[model samples]
Target: MRKNKLSFQERAGSLQEECLCFCEEASREAMFQAPIELPEGFVIDPAEAVTNVTWNADSLSCVSERCFIETGPEPDEIAVQFAVRLQGTVTLLVSVSPVRNQYGQGNGAVSVIHSAEIDQVVYYSDEPDDCPDFSDIRIENLVVVPPFYGSPLSVTGTIVLVPEPDQRSYVFTANSGDSTVSVIDTEVNTLVSNISLSDIPTDLGVTLDKAYTYVLHGNANLVSIINNETLTVTQTTPLAGAPRKIQFETGGEFAYILAGGSSIYEINISSQTITNTFTVSPAADDFALDPNGQFFYTTNSGIWVVNKYDIKTGQLIDRLSNLETPNVIETPLIGDFAYLENGELRPNVVSVIDLTTFSKSSQINRLFDGLITIVFSDDGTRAFFLEPFPENLTVVDTAQHTMITTASLPGASDIAVTPDNQYIYAAQPDDNTVTVYRTSDYTAVSVIPVGTGPAAIAM
Candidate 1:
């Protein structure tokens, strides 16, 4: 009784594998979350050079789902390549290269305007007369019907291109109140770009190949680095301190900057500079990074210590003390354990810390007062945060440390979750909106508005 869909005629030239790949529900990891045009001039080349596998799918043209794209049209260009089809794992990719035209002898028909719950796939190039008659193919879902779509390319002439597909996921929002970062587009939730940041951004990261997005700025301590294909900010770099947390380094070379709370630099993601430096004798406003990459949790509010550094020689490996004013430090996308949070405006307490055994096992208390960010649940079992004088949103079950529900997000200032935990976005800076909850029943499924003071979010 499980059938959402699945089809793939798989044929080409001479009608041999001309192309058809339909997937559905959860079969073969069916995918294609939105944005699917591409037939007109076509322009999507996420650097277009795939080798092993790791594709950023989007709709019929961009070739959705687990990936594996192959193209070969060279009278002018037709190079779409990507390959990450896993199960037994077969890697072979090469997309984006065809742009030549005028090969239309009789008729053509290449359609997939979407919404049939898609996972669309396409392929062509077995000498169908060489294929390539898109003098103005145009697309936005794609439907270029010419005169040949009857199980044939019309006297053997087939040239139907598809290229518009760039919107699988995105949600950057770092509105340091107004310095701007915005971005959203998690498949049509909208607010596509907004970028302008000169100061105050404070935390946002992504780059395991999401193509770059590292912003941290508080009083201009700077770091700005964006380039998600060209949303531009290219690089800013400067940071002697003042910024506050920005992690990455699950082997992608390196990155970890938790500024002037007593320094901790170390970046170098392909030369975005700052190779190494780590100090914290009496500084630590926030910092956490040990998703198994090897420790560096810092959080101090009035001497309640919690430092642990040494994510590769930054030294000073331990100090865990009794917590009470812990500031903020989070780490749990996979866990070795660490949460911290502490208190300041009144009642607060998260403190989990258990990097294997560096101690302080559990806490989780919160009458409110502070907890703007802290997400986890890529199977870590749940743990979300955000509760500032009743802006409420807490959900946490991290293996039984309780508090399984709460929802009201009045002015919520930051939160992000969606690696499949279903959804939960909240960033309402006084109604500039961002909402979008539904981790099963937390409700409110859409809001979007974004800009003015969005605070922080990432994914």
Candidate 2:
């Protein structure tokens, strides 16, 4: 007898009392089963499907037992399609002729026939709705292409999904010689306020929550915590020695301070007390924390080495030696690699280290002379480095390990890229101005005058 194939077609509508049935002719001793797969942001109840299953989101339980909905990353406004395939097989019990068990009982074993692709189901999100009703939403050939993951660093870059806006973005500049921090409204391209401090601010570290900005005073042996919203100093916590650099953990619960030239101090932000301290040989010129907050990378200027230390125990986990006066270090948002700017006294090269192996992966050379500072795009695709001697900004592609282009900025002392990766801001202390360039075209967008000696910028 010929087996009849099963098929169904329906228009897009609300999933209400929808049932898809699969039937096939079989003998009395035969059984059949069909398994289904779902897309990324979807789910199906096992009770409704009568089989093993996985769900995209748990909140969709209130919607329908058989329905799969969008609950993962934000979907593009344009139509997206998902393909589903169904696999089916038959099982049967067979008994050997005249075979008896030792206990005088006939024995039989169950066997399954090879499964084959039986059906194809395609789902289309062609309509504009947060939760569109899927038609005959059953499990089978599951195909899904998620929307873009993050915003492009440049205009020509790939599209990415960005986080929802909550708080306004502002630029924080640490004036090393002026003993003050200038706050600039990035949207307006103007200076909004100048925060006064007792000592010169050497570096700036913003909390993950963006609630507080920590300013390290190079001469005062203190870290000033500034409330970002009110733009005022909330508290000042004294350290063991003058802090060379400050790095915050992802949770903002504690901060790691490289102080007193050779010791690392971990401070609890809420209690404003030193919780732990670890000492190292010689002082580190710069350092950066990994994304997981498990370890940190510090550069020893004297010995020309980069040491990795465990954040909890302060134990040296790994070291990349044989470097040339590693002066500045930066890690991208992903934290998979570290980019170290070797000083001009040594070769003009940026040592790239793979965080996983803690080894020098490659070197980006011929970037510029007299390397002042370096900053990365939010997505970690491009790096912007400042060379004050030549007064130029060099942009390097992180993936290709090559120089992309160089732009001229007179007296470019420091460089910073916005969180949205839309613009690049370079501080020219000689000109006493900050020049903004569009990331897409590297063209000058605007210039705003700041206080004297604008040395560092934080976003």
Look at candidate 2 and tell me the lDDT of residue 139.
Answer: 34
Worst 10 residues of 1 by lDDT: 151-160
**Candidate 2 at 240: error in angstroms?**
1.7
Q: For residues 403-425, what per-residue lDDT tens digits would candidate 1 score against the true structure?
A: 77777867777777887888878
- Could you give candidate 2's per-residue lDDT for residues 244-330 as a string of tens digits? 777777667988888976888888887767899988765777788886778987887788888888888888888877777777898
What lDDT does each candidate get?
Answer: 0.62, 0.63
For candidate 1, report its TM-score: 0.28
**Best by the TM-score measure:** 2
